[model samples]
Target: MKFAQPLWNDLKCQLQDGFILDTSWTNIYLPNAQILGIGKDITAHKQSKQVLNTQIEQEKLMRNIA
Candidate 1:
């Protein structure tokens, strides 16, 4: 039996509603030339991180002004 190694990747997808979707995907290849993939949504996590980063930058600016 021959099998391709499994791989993982992070992808970004854009929706018609103008929302960005972050996904982590895992791909597995089978001996019969079939491939299977699984994806998990991480939009909320990414958005939260962006908010936190902005907050941190604002705090830094305020500190510099002090």
Candidate 2:
């Protein structure tokens, strides 16, 4: 059996903050089956770090002047 393509894509990228995942499989004499998973890209973390660094630098400059 084949599943929908968009549904599969969505499943692969559905990671959210503080969400836990559990996996299970059943064997019922089926021919074949597949499970899909998704996760966030590392770029998201990098971008967040850049924003935080900018905020910290701004705070530091403000303190030095005052």
Candidate 3:
């Protein structure tokens, strides 16, 4: 029997309506050469994090300018 290590990655997938998805996914390979996958939508979380980071950087810059 053989198996592969579980895989974890973020991917962009296009939907039928042309809306793209940002996802966090995991893939598992079984001993029989079959694969199982699970995914979660993370577009909102990623966008929120990016916005927070930009705000933090702006705050830092403002502090420096003061």
Candidate 4:
């Protein structure tokens, strides 16, 4: 596949075992053709973001009531 084409992309993917991954991918073709990728476990970050959103909504409601 690398020999045919070179490309890069960033995506969030879920594995077959039901795990999620945040991926950063890159392809290079200069001295040699290479494909590189990296990922992080962002489950905690996602949960934190949801909690923050919920807190923001609650704050908004409280301000309106007051």
Candidate number with greatest lDDT: 3
Q: lDDT of each model, Cα atoms only? A: 0.86, 0.51, 0.89, 0.69
Order the numbered candidates by lDDT, best leading: 3, 1, 4, 2
- Model 3 gets an lDDT of 0.89
Q: List model 1 lDDT by residue over 1-66, tens digit each.
A: 665555768899888998888988997766678877888898798889999999999999999999
Candidate 3, 1-66: lDDT as tens digits: 555566779999899999998998998776689877989999999899999999999999999999
Q: Is candidate 2 or candidate 4 better by TM-score?
A: 4
Task: Compose the digit string of candidate 2's lDDT tens values, residues 1-66.
Answer: 773433211122224785443322222333356543444345455558889999999999999999
* Candidate 1 error regions (>4 Å): 1-7, 16-18, 29-35
As for candidate 3, its clashing pairs are none
Model 2 alpha-carbon drift over 4 Å, by segment:
1-40
TM-score for each of the candidates: 0.64, 0.39, 0.76, 0.57
Lowest-sum lDDT 10-residue window in model 2: 5-14
Error of 3 at 40 (Å): 1.2
Backbone clashes in each candidate structure, one number apiece? Answer: 0, 1, 0, 0
Candidate 4: C-alpha RMSD after superposition: 6.5
- lDDT for position 63 in model 4: 100
